[model samples]
Every structure is written in C-alpha cells, then in structure tokens.
Target: MELFTVKSIGKVCVDKKGTRLKLDKEYIPALTNLEGFSYINILWWFDQCDHSDSRSKLIEKSPYKDSPEMLGTFATRSPERPNPIALTCANITYIEAENGVVGLAYMDAEHGTPILDIKPYTPSLDRVENPSMPQWCASWPKNVETSGDYDWSKVFNF
Candidate 1:
C-alpha cells in the first residue's frame, strides 16, 4: 500500500453512544476558515486499543463477544486490530474557538489520541450503496438501536 504523509493528528472524543466528540481549541483557526464543508472524514488512532494482543493482529469475534461471531478486524469495526486505527464520517455542525486556538467537530475519540488526517467528506465521492460489509453485520441494528441514543453527546463520548 502507498503511504501518505499525515499533516496533523487529533483525538476523537466521543460519548457513549458514539456521536459528538470534543475537539481542542487549537484546531479552531484552520477548520473554521473553510466554508461549504458540512461533513468531514475523521481519521483517528485507537490508542486505547491493545495492539500488543496477538489476537488483535488479525481479527476475531466482536470485541464484545455477545455481539457476533468471530470475524476479521478488517471485516469488523471492532477497535481491536494491528493498526488500531478508526475512521468515521461525521457531520460538521459548526466551528467554535476563542482566540484562534483550533477546535474542530466533536467526535468519538479520546483525548490525546493521534489524529491521522482530516479531509472534507465529499458526499459524491465517499457515499456508496450496498457496499460489502460482513455476515455478522448482515442484519446490523440501526444506529439508534445498536448503540442506542443518536444524541451528539452519547454518540461521540462512548
């Protein structure tokens, strides 16, 4: 695979339900200057994940065993994996900052976690229909039911 240099890395602070996360004020100046960007691609490092576990090297059952049968890390969204990286598409509500510190959207990542990269979420290019998922997720529950509340706080902090 080709490697791309990362411009900056940031933490994805999400609530329990996996929604809105807190961004540092330092990022405010850069993200705020842009307009017409309603959504963004969140690239984060799953620092909390134990990459040392050999089991995380390849893949296995859902980290939460009760959720599904065994599967590959690439196949599932489970945080356990070799790279321990997580990516998500989030809607950008608005940018907030004081004194041009630098804060972006609130996401479901932890503080201090490395932000691999941030790109404009282009609907025309990113959105795909009927993409291949996995058998375990064949009948995946709705976001609200699976993770529960779709509220911003719950979604990003979880």
Candidate 2:
C-alpha cells in the first residue's frame, strides 16, 4: 500500500452551524487561469472531531439523536467512522484572492477545519444518473418535526 503525502492545507473556516469547517475557494480562478478547470472536489478533515477512538466503532443513530433505527455509519452521514473526513461537490461561485476570499454555497463543513485537497469537480467524468441514496434519505419521516430555532453554543462544545 502506497501512501501519498499532501503538500499543504488551505484556509480554515467554520460552518454556518458553527460546528464544522470550510476550505478556501481562492484557488479556482487560478485553476481556470492555469489549468482551464472550473469546478472542484473538496476533501476536508472534520478536524474539530475526535473520531480516532470511535473510528472502528460503527453506529446507526443520527447525529441529532432522533430519527429511526441504527443504520451503518457508511449508510448514514453520521461523521463517525474509520476516518472523520468528508468531501463535497461545490460550484465555485467565485474566487477573489485579491480580497483574500472565496465563496461557495451548499457547503456542509464547519470553520477552521483543515482542507486536505481540492480537485476540479469534472462533470463529464463525474456525473451519474439516479445514484442510489440511503433509505433514510428517500423522504421526510412523518414522525420527524423541527422546532426550527437552533443555538450553536448548546449544540456544539469546543
């Protein structure tokens, strides 16, 4: 088994929920300018997370502590697993390094998390149709409801 060494980690920032991190988008234009690429694949470490001890342990429960029966960690995006890391496909809305900023939407990562890597999100090679998602993701549960209001302090402890 060969291991790859990373060159560096990019900008660190938290998620809107204040529980996760987001990476810098400043490399996109430079990517397009140099490599003619538009989109990217973002690999980030859920750094604030301490999942090493629980990495081998699997759980079926939802992070919110609600929902239904136990589902495998891989079956659920519980953020608990062999590696407490996550990736997402995002559209690079824009990158303004002159101002030292990058903008991305629909990002689920939190602030200050280390950005492991970024690769162009190539749709030509990456697009798929009707991907099979988990059962819990199919529809809204009848019994599940939300009070809506959320307090970050109570939900996440640093």
Candidate 3:
C-alpha cells in the first residue's frame, strides 16, 4: 500500500463566542472568492482518535440505536478508523479572508480540531434526491434542513 503525508491547513475553534475555522496564515489566500459559496464541506482530523488502537480498529459495536450489532468501520461514522478523518457540511456565516478566520453557522467538530481541507459544497455533485438506507434509520430526518431540529438522542445508542 502507498503511504501518504497529510498536514492540517487550519483548526476548528468553538468558544463562548461561536464556532469557526481558523486557517493558517499561509492558507489565507486560498479563501479568496470562497464567500460566494453558501456551504462548505470540511475535512478534519479526529485528533482524539489518532492513537494506534483507534487507527487499527476495523469493526465497532453499533453506535446507532436499532442498527446492526456489529458494523465495519466504514459502515458507521465512528471517529476510530484506519484513518481518523471526518467530513462535515456546514453553512458559512461569515468569512474574514485577510484574518484567515471563517464564521460557521454550526459544525459538529470540537474546538482545536485540526482541519485537513475545505471544499465548496456543490449541490450538483453532492446531493442525492433518493437515498436508500436500512429500515432502522428510515425514521431519521430526511434532509439537512430538518436535521437541526431532529431529536438525535433517540437515534444514538449512547
């Protein structure tokens, strides 16, 4: 297998003020014209799960209620995986290109989480009008718009 070298371009910051992505000074120029996009797909590292044991995990006990008892790492969004990477789509609240900070409406990531990359969320390439899934999650929220109000506590096993 081929090996890869990855570096963090920025970090997520969540404070009493708000949540945002603070890009490195060198990466600030990449944010040019990014304000045109309404949403962005953020690629971040699961730093907390970057240990040898977490990276070696290929299977996990299901974390979703009513889901399969045991699931392969790829089947669920567990932070522990061969690569401790995560992707999240977030709405852009504001952007400070010169300052290299982005205001996000909401992101599931925690403060100080390393950001791997950021991509504009293009509907043409990302949306799926009809997605097939197991019956267990059929009752879950159907779209991102409604997901905010969804009672996720009921769906998570934890």
Candidate 4:
C-alpha cells in the first residue's frame, strides 16, 4: 500500500482556563468565515493512545457497564485504534479568526492534542433524523444538546 501523510493545522488548548483550538500561523487564514457556524466537527489525533499496544488493540472488554462483555474495536468509541484519530462535534463558544483561536463549549480531546482539521457542522450533511444503534446504548442521548446533561458516568464503566 502507498504511504499517506497527515499534518496538524492546529492544536487543542485544554486547560483550567478553557478549551480552544489554536491554529498554526499558516492556517490562520483558513479560519475565515468559520464563525458563521454554531458547531464544528473537529478531527484530532489521539496522541496519548498512539503507542503500539494501543494501536494494536482490536477488542475492548466492556467499556460500557450494560453492554456486551467483549466489543470489537469498531463497535466501541475506545481510544485504542489503528489510526488513533477522533472526531467530536462541539458547540462553538466564540471564534477569533484573526488570532486563529476558536473557543469551544466542549471537546473530548486533551491539551496539546494535534488538530487534523475542522469542518462546519452542517445538519443537512452531518445529522441523521433517525439513526439506529445497539440496544445497549439505546438509552443514550439523542443529540449533542441533550448529551450535555446526560449522566455519562452511569453508562460508561470506566
């Protein structure tokens, strides 16, 4: 197979201060007009889980309490994966295009995580009116808005 390459356009700034995306100087222009969207799909690297052992993990041993005991890597949103990449649809708190900074309401990424890319969250293309899932997770939140108030600790084992 031919080798492919991916580069970070920015980094996630997560701290006690807040969560934000700080784009590289060269990618600052790319943030133009991004403020128009209320939400954004962030593609980021799971840098902390990029080790060989994590990458080779193909099965997760019940990350969810009520789910099946063994779940294939693809079946669960576990960080251990071959690509070690993650996607999160986060609400935009604010955007500073000139300074290349985007404040976010929430992001499931660690501080200093490499940001692969950012795309406007268009419901027309990204949302599904009705999506099916396993019965195990049937009680999960139906949308991102509702997910904020969800009791995730009850759903997740870890």
Candidate 5:
C-alpha cells in the first residue's frame, strides 16, 4: 500500500467573537488573491470522530428519518467514515489576506477543528445544475443561499 502524509494548514475558530479560519504563519503566503472569492470550500478534519471504532463503522443506522433503514457509510455524511474528513461551502464575510485570517458567515465545522485545505468556490467547477438526489432529500434547498433558512431538523434523525 502507498502511504501519504496530510498536514493541517490551519484551524476553524468558532467563538463568541466570530467564526474564522486562522491559518498558520507559514501558510500566510498561500492566502494571496483569495479575497476575490465570495465563497470558499473548506476541507477539514473530523477530529472528534478520528477513532478506531468510528473508522471501522461501515454502516449507519438511518441518519435520516425518511431514509432507508441501513445505509453504507458513504451514503450519508456521517463523520464515522474511513477517513474522518468533512467539506463545507461557507460564505465569505471578510478576509485579511496579509494576516491569513478569513471571516465567514457560517461553517458547519466546530471550534478548533483542523482545516486540511481551502479552495475558492468557482461556479464553473463547483456548481451543479439540475442535480438528482434520492427522493428523501428531494425537498431540500435548491442552492446554498436558501440553505441557510432550511429546516435541517426535518431531515436529520438524530
């Protein structure tokens, strides 16, 4: 088997002050020109779920109330995958390019979560039009903007 090394470039900071991505000093240069983006796709580590038991979980017992009784790990966005990684598209509120700090309107990540990578959200490559999904989630929001007001509790069974 081939081995690869992954390093954390920064961490997601969710506090009373605000939600932001605090990049390490060494990665400050990488933030150059990122301000032009209105949104960013954040790849982060699910640190809390990085355990032997979590990693070994291959099936989930219906995370959605209206979904199938059993779902493969990949079918749902549960943190208990073989690799505890997560991705979220967050709206950019502000950016301090020089200081490597980025403020966001909202992010699904929790406080102190390690950020693996950040990519600008370009419509050309990121947007999906007329995408199909399971009937259970068909009533979900159509776009990211409207998703903020969506009643997520109705979908999640937890």
Candidate 6:
C-alpha cells in the first residue's frame, strides 16, 4: 500500500458565536481573495474517527431512515471509512483575512477538527445541473441553500 502525509492548515472552532475556521498563521496568506464567494468547499479531517478500527470499516448499516439495509462506506457520508476525511460545502459568513479566521454559518464537523484544505465554491466546476440519485434520497433538498431549512431529522436514522 502507498502512504501519504497530510497536514492541517487550520482547525474548526465552534462557540456561542457559531462556527469558524481558524487557519494557522502560515495559512493566512492563502485566504487572501477568498472573500466575495458566497460558499466554499471545506476539506477536513474526521479527527474523532481517525482510528484503525474506523479506517478498516468499508461497509456500514444504512444510516438513512428509508435507505437500503446496508451500504458501502462510499455510499453513505459516515465518518467511519478508510480515510477519515470529510468534505462540506459551507456558507461563508465572513472572512477576517488579517486574523486568518473564516466565519461559517454551519459545518458538520466538531470543534477542533483539523481543516485539510479550502476551495472557493465555483458552481461551474462543482455544481451538477441534473445529477441522478437513489430513489430514497431523491426527496432530499436539491441544493445546499435549501438544506438549511430542511428537516434533516426525517431523513437521518437515529
């Protein structure tokens, strides 16, 4: 097997104020010109799930309310997988370039989670006009904009 090394450019901070991505001083310059974009794709590490056991998990019982009985790790967004990496498209509330802080409306990651990378959310390259999905999830929100108001509780299995 091949090996790779990944370093965190920042960490996620969540508090009463809300979520924020605090980049390392070295990564501050990279945030320049990142403003103006309404959204961004945050690639982060699943710190809590970075265990050997989690990495070995390749399949999972369906985590959705009305999905198949079982699913491969790639099929579901579960953090338990070969590589504990997560990608989330977050709304950019504000960007403090000097402080190297990027305010976020929300992120599925926990506080202190390591940020792998960040990229502007360009619809031309990231958006899919009419992509197909399984019937079970077809009723889900069509876009990230509507996902905020969506009653996700009805879709996720507890």
Which candidate leads the pack in TM-score?
A: 6
* Index of the highest-lDDT prediction: 6
- Model 4, residue 122: distance off in Å is 0.3
Question: Deviation in angstroms for 50 in model 6?
Answer: 0.5
Better of 1 and 3 by TM-score: 3
Tell me the tens digit of each residue's lDDT in model 2 across 49-131: 55566676587454432345566787665566777777876555565544434466446776555677766766678776556
- Encode model 4's per-residue lDDT on 1-158: one tens digit a residue: 57779999999999897999999999999988786799999999999998999999998798797889999999977889998999999999998899999999999898999999999999999999999989999999999999999999999876
Could you give me the TM-score of model 6 versus the true structure?
0.98
Each candidate's root-mean-square deviation in Å?
6.2, 7.1, 0.9, 0.9, 0.9, 0.7
On residues 88-121, what C-alpha lDDT tens digit does candidate 3 reach at each position? Answer: 9999999999999999989989899999999999
lDDT of 3: 0.93
Total clashes, candidate 4?
0
lDDT of 5 by residue, 1-158 (tens): 67789999999999997999999999999998897799999999999999999999999798787888999999888899999999999999999988889999999889999999999999999999989999988898999999999889998876
lDDT of each: 0.57, 0.54, 0.93, 0.93, 0.93, 0.95
Greater lDDT among 2 and 3 belongs to 3
> Residue-wise lDDT of candidate 1 within 27-119, one digit each (tens)?
655565545777777777777784488434675644432345555677666677766767866666654434422234445666566676667
- Cα error, candidate 3, residue 75 (Å): 0.6
What is the TM-score (0 to 1) of candidate 4?
Answer: 0.97
Question: Can you give the TM-score per candidate against the true fold?
Answer: 0.61, 0.61, 0.96, 0.97, 0.96, 0.98
Candidate 5 Cα lDDT to native: 0.93
- Residue 135, candidate 6: alpha-carbon lDDT: 97
